[model samples]
Target: MSDVVKPAVPPPATPARALLPLVLPALVIGLGSSLLLAAVSEAAELFKDVLWETLPDAIGIGRWSVGWIMAVLTATGIAVGLVVWKAPGHAGPDPATTGLVDAPLSPRVVPGLLLATGLALAGGVSLGPENPITAANIALAYWLGRRLVPGSSGQVWAALGAAGTVGALFGTPVAAALILTESLAAAPRPQNPAERTPSLWDQLFAPLVAAGAGGVTSKLLGVPSFGLSLPAFDGPRWPDLLAALLVAPVAAVLGLAAVYAFPYVHRAFRMLPHPVLALTLGGVVLGLLGALGGHLTLFKGLDEIGELAADPKGHSAGALVMMTVVKLAAVLVACGSGFRGGRIFPSVFAGAAFGLAVHALVPAVEPSVAVTCGVLGLLLAVTRQGWLSLFTAAVIAPGIGLLPLLCLALLPAWLLVTGRPQMQLDESGAALR
Candidate 1:
């Protein structure tokens, strides 16, 4: 081979390596999207508060009165039906079934989804619009990215969209990044390993940009995302640790029981001829639960946190126990029967009630502290996110003094729930295919 041969050229960078080139842009886009989502949430909250204020007058009724509430429920059912019919994809399925993943959405469906979510919230369903808002944010980001980056892969755009949505909704860039990675693990994609691994640096930078955007947006829109700042505990005591240990097994049993119960309930409800009929039945169940447990079990429960905080004594310990059971049943029915909403808030409500009941029984641990730990522990079991549970416990508790105790409680709770069966779904809104 006497002829001089030219040196071989290296192969072009892999899609994964090429991720570096896109990172900065993706981060910027994520930040913008986060801010946009924050604005949406803020606006939605304002609209909801205003609606609540005027709703009684509009219906010519008293606030929280039986008639007024029933009117709200019926309107909520109709609105949900319209949204599901008009924008099928926008109506998010049960979060317990969907887990915490972000699903892709078409731009065409965003408006209808948003409208439906807003209407549903205004009508006072025992649901939160955060998931739908998150979906809409992701959809918008995907649409914008595709228009801007014509040759970009759908997977990349979808991931970016999800990242943006998470950053906006969570106010934690790191958390949002993790959520995106976890969510995309199940999505369809190219088989090449080289194309699969996005760089850590890019991942880190993208969420940071999105976080900044979210913070700025929240500030501009006057939305509150109260940081983690609980009161200092005297310290973690043996009693608290022992109590946590005791609670862990109980929580595990309850969680396992819930997973098994949800499917049967859902299957039974699915026998209804229509989604509306299914939801009407759900409304009746919730109404009965509400009537039994009082107004605490009726709504998405975000507003009730303040009341719970202000006067824990106002609620009889027995009522808390009953409310806990009733709310759990209501959430299971709501999700299983195909109502569109998130289970996170309802889970928190149930956990808080459970914790409060536990504290009442023990009388050794501070009720507030017990409530805080229970909230964190139960949510950790349900969501499978330790840090989020930690943060939630710290924030929701009246003081920070219980953080160490809460942390101690979370480990056993996690251990108990780990490896347990999770809710199964074939796809979005389809019967177990």
Candidate 2:
């Protein structure tokens, strides 16, 4: 018989039972990592109460004046500078240069990073705990994974770490899944289904499991969802479209301005031989911004954003625009310096301020919708992650009605930012184009 060799069929992707080893560990790490991250935030708040409120009240500095703001931020800079320069592991890598996913730094660096983050957060730096917390969680998770599940691949660890962090940060599995799906969708695939290459579902299964676990744990722990008290979107109308068209592009332009300035500021700070000097100088500048923008602009911006939204009409359009500028400037200073924190929260805050300004100017526009669109445009340019920007806008806007408006608004925003300078530092600390 003239025989033809047959290609063997790959066993139906590994059975669910085979995923048990990964699922269990991922669940554990995800939950534990989320708790750890939450704990850090909680601790920062506690210390903030002491440093900001308790201390101020104790000494009878009931209200913070510009001089006090300057003193505190400058002091923060000195402390952060010392940590970066003399601390072991150099307070980990510069956050501006890192991506959402990267190799974990040496375990030794963890303590310094945490210390620096706590110092910044409590001292009113315009940053969030996101980057530092994610890095810490990933390093911790990976370390445990290797010892506990030696058979697991690095891909699994990366996926689980990312999912866990996203879940913890956003308090939902959907954010993590959507973000990962976008990245994984275009990855190279093996033609042979029977090969060891994992199927997409199989690859996603554990991360989703981890994400779900982290999200559930956070909910159980009573973490709050992000939201603003505002009116719902009316059915998409011509005016709505027109407003979004005008708002998003303007937001994108503002974002580009920040992106352009990011590297130069970073370079200017880096030129200082001593980390202390760089961070100290950054703090002094931030103090001035806070002084000019008012106490609302001093911190990472979540609370300030809530305040802004609580009474959108209370502040005048000029005031909102000024807040936007000051906040953006604060973000540039915090990120460019050696502060151990994130830019996302401040970026969103700045975007919201810009949106509020637009709404004030164009009374035809809906306030909440403008805020959502502004956030979407800013994030689209800042993170270069379209889905995340859209998702976050929907999440923050408080209803499904705004989704259509946000989606339409995103298109024009994307065009403006697609090839522009990104808000990231290249290897040599220059803007990535």
Worst ten-residue run, lDDT, model 2? 192-201
**Cα RMSD for candidates in order:** 6.4, 3.7
Kindly report which residue stretches of model 1 are placed more than 4 angstroms away from their true locations once superposed: 1-51, 58-60, 88-97, 177-199, 226-232, 397-404, 428-433
TM-score of 2: 0.93
Q: Worst lDDT window (10 residues) for model 1?
A: 223-232
Runs of candidate 2 with Cα error greater than 4 angstroms are 1-12, 186-197
Q: How many backbone clashes does candidate 1 have?
A: 7
Give each model's clash number.
7, 1
Give lDDT per model, in order.
0.63, 0.84
Best by lDDT: 2
TM-score, one value per model: 0.81, 0.93
